[model samples]
Target: MADELTTRSALQLRDLVAHGEVSAEEVARAHLERVAATDDQLKAFVTVTDDAALAHARDIDRRRAAEEPVGALAGVPLALKDVLCTKGVRTTCGSRILQTYRPPYDAGVVERLRDADVVVLGKANCDEFAMGSSCENSAFFPTRNPWDLDRVPGGSSGGSVAAVAGFQAPLGVGTDTGGSIRQPAALCGLVGVKPTYGAVSRYGLIAFASSLDQAGPIARSVTDAAHLLAAIAGPDPRDSTSIPKPLPDVLAGLDDGVSGLRIGVVAEFMAEGMSDGVRAMVEASVERLAGLGAEIVEVSLPHAGYGLAAYYLIAPSEASSNLSRYDGVRYGLRVDGATTEAMMAATREAGFGSEVKRRIMIGTYALSAGYYDAYYAQAQRVRTLIARDFAAAFETCDVLVGPTSPTVAFPLGELTADPLAMYANDVYAVPASLAGLPAMSLPVGLGEAGMPVGFQIMAPLLRDDLMLRAARALEAEVGFDAMPRGPNALAGAAI
Candidate 1:
């Protein structure tokens, strides 16, 4: 029953609960059992809320018994990336500094989830402060890919994607600063959406890069992601930057196929460095869309090569500023040393992992007096050029298409020694993020690594529904969810 329940989509489970085919308590219990049976190897969760989930499930059962109104997501169990706060839950952003820190209130998204009657499973693991492209930076433990445990699950949302793909949960939330969500979604073969900047409120998500950070959903299918987005998206007075637009009928838009729409296949994507397998898959995706009656247009974004360099500078600079509050004074782990100031320095030095410190130092240097103009300011201007490039490309087409990443999932330790190479992993994703465009990752097919390869679909800012509609069409046409290996293949392996 647990395996059967875990395999179902969140919408399917919701319907079952609503129709009394299964009770909320049973669904919640089944998820908890799956988590217990699998999480030790996956390390997908930073914390699991067994008690709170069951209690919420009981409350749902009681409400249903009284015939009270329940939200569409009533009793659906979902996991949140630890980057989002939850009241009293140890919302460690996979960093040692915040290992013991618990927030006093729920994040805006968490409140929305509660209102939707979704049960909180726990906080998923993430790269420290959402910095690394892989989950390896997590001070707790790395989240391995469910498909191949020895390989990485693209991150900083690795845990959330792994949790969903590993059948720990049906849906989860993830943030994309520079392809953090989409890259991982592509790697994990799940549908990951990074809505237009300001489309979803960032009130409770720990700041990564203020301008680039936006939260959305990660689920097994395009429809599931759309449903989760509908539940959490809307204006939140708490986040001043949040767009106050009315939610789109995302679920209703799922049936809109890719007929007579113009799809842009960015020429830069097919340039040198893209693996043959990835190119073949993306080309196949274009053919599939063409078969669906969509026109394929070749578009150029000349300055896209600068996206990675600009993103590293800007993201780290903002991270340096946002992380200044953690001086071991107000919150998080503190060190016991000679003096107050010394202890603060020691705490940070000892608590933060090597990668986190490296980025912070890089960011601090970029923002420092002499280097500010050359690094930070220059990066911002380059950002402007990239945005302009997107504007020009969008003029010719309704959506942009490309392989989500250059290659498929690699072994866990493959790129650890080369930080620049690891950062380059997001080459395809950072461009959309820098432009603040709405982009989603839909699995196209398996690549040479026997793991999923996702095709990224980018729509103009605030055109999230069109992006979803296009992705749903492609997803339906190229169904890639069929697992390559049996569950027993991963039986004793840690993901």
Candidate 2:
């Protein structure tokens, strides 16, 4: 019973726990067992709060026994990407600098998840400071792709996706500044959502890019992602950037289906440079959606060509400013030196991974006074143009469709040598983030070398429900349930 329980979704687990088929304690214990057995090679977690998780589960059980009303996600387990602050837990963002740091308060989302009765299994690994496109930047260890250990798990949020794909957890939270969540979801063969900028609160979340960072969920299925989003999405007074609109029940209308949905396929995404297998998979997904009554039309975002340059300038610029707070002063791993500035610089140099340093330097250079107009301001103007492009495209369509990543999961070090190539992996995704639109990656097919490919769906801001409905529709049609299989305990396959 415990073994079978690990594969169930948060929604399914909730039902079982509510009906007494499985206790909240049993669900937590099973997930804890899976994490202990598999996380060594997967490196999915930086910290596992076994005692606290079980205690929370037991409290839920006690509440149920007392006949108190239980939340919709009661007793289900979820993994937090180490970027989110959790009180009393070491919330390292896969960086050595803050390995022993414990946040004083739970992030707004963490508090809400706790309120919803979701058990947090642990803090999952991520690219240090969420800088890299692959998980390799983690200072401790890289999170291996669940499909093939020898390959990379598309990242920044690689551990979150790997945790879900490897069945270590039913739900995982990730942030997408520029495809961090969706790219990993694409590679790991799972569902990941990046809500419109400010759709979810960023308070207590270690900032990546102030304007673009948004925390969301990675799950095995679209509905599971929706349920997790429903739990975490809402305005928070603590975060001024959080949208104040009431969050509609995302899971309420899942059965509405996707007939008559206007889903536009961006010509820019379908153009040359994409892998043949990825193209075929996306084309097949479009056809499948068309068969389901989606009006597939070609749309153009001409300025989309400039997205990479603009994102590179904008994201890093913001990252440089946001990361300045970690100067070894107020928190963990401080280094004393002859002078304060030297000490701070030395601490950062020794603490951050190479990717983090690269971005900070790039941002510092770009934001310098003489270069500001040439880079930062120009990038902002380009951002406006990109947002306008999406607006114009949305005028004729309800949603947009394309491949989430240009290619599937590449090998571990394939693009690490070329920073530009690494940034290009986010080609299809940055446009949506720049526009503050809701987007999701749905596993569509296997790409070259049989790695999972994701079909990205974009919706107008605040219309996450429409995008999710369409994705769930495509999910049913594609039926892409390609989990890695063998006698390797699923651990060896992922590690």
Candidate 3:
């Protein structure tokens, strides 16, 4: 019974716990046990709050015993990416500088999780400051894909996806700046969503690129992701960029199939850099959608090809500004020196990893005095053009479709020495992020190397529900298996 608990979806656990078939404590314990059993090899978690998680679960059971009303997600397990502050829990942002730093208050989303009664298993690891395309840039360790233990679980949000894919947790929260959530979800063979820029509040979320960093849900199924996303989506006065309006009821029309809806295929995305297996799977998924009463149309995003170049400039520029707060002063690590300037330099030199340092330099150079207009301003103009491209494409279609990543998961350290090669992996995902659109990566089926292939869906800004409906409609048809079958997966697990 305990082992079976680890295999159930978030909604399954919630129903079981709500109906008294299984106590919340049992559910939490089952996943914690799985974490203990597999995290050594997967390195998905930076810290495991076993005691706090079990205690919270027990409290939920207590409340239910007294006939008290519960939140929407009353009893389910979640793996929170370390970038979100958790009050007493350490929020490392997967960087060595802040490894021991704990926030004094919870992020807005964390507060929502507590209200919803979601049990957070732990703080999952990630690329230092969410800077890299692969999980290899973490200051402490790398996260391995559950589908193949030897490969990366695409990154920045790699650990969050790893935990959910490996059955250590049924749900996760990962921020997407440039495909951090979707890319990892694609590689790990799970579902990951990136809400529109202002759909979710960013208060207490450690900023990477303030304009692009939006946290979303990671789950094994689209329904579970919708549940998680709704619970955390709302306006917050603390976040100026947050949308004043509320997100619609995503679950209400989730089962509304793709009949009579137009799904646009980006001509640029399907034309290049696709591996044979991934191309085959994507084409097949599109055909399957067409057979489900959806109109298939070809759309062109002329400026889409420039998304990667613009993102590298804009994201790093914001990162360079946001990360300047860690100057050996207010919080986190501080190395003492005779002069204050020397102290700050020494601390940063030791605290930041190679990738983080690299981006900071690039951003600094781009935002420097003379080059601001030439580089930074030019990139913003290009970003506007990408948004226009998306607008033009959406004029004729309800949603746009493409392969999430060009290829499936690659072996760890394969492109570590080649930064450009690693950055190219985000070609399909960066465009949507640049446009501040709601996008998701849905697991179509297994592709090259028996790894997962992601069928990405993009909807107009604030219309995340359309993509969810489209994804759910096809998810039912394809029936992709998310359970990990790797050597490190839980015993009895199958792909």
Best by TM-score: 3
Q: Write the per-residue lDDT of candidate 3 for residues 77-99, one digit (tens) a residue.
A: 99999999998899999898998
Q: Which stretches of candidate 2 lie over 4 Å from their true place?
A: 486-495
Question: Arrange candidates by lDDT, highest first: which order?
Answer: 3, 2, 1
lDDT of 1: 0.88
Q: Rate residue 284 of model 1 by lDDT.
A: 98
> Which residue window of length 10 is worst by lDDT in model 2?
486-495
Clashes of each: 0, 0, 0
Which regions in candidate 3 have their CA more than 4 angstroms from the true location? Answer: 486-491
Name the lDDT of candidate 3.
0.92
- Candidate 2 per-residue lDDT over residues 278-369, each given as its tens digit: 99999999999889998989999999999988999999999999889889899967877789998998889888888999999999999988
The C-alpha RMSD of each candidate to the native structure, in angstroms, is: 1.9, 1.7, 1.3
Candidate that beats the other on lDDT, 2 or 3, i.e. the better one: 3
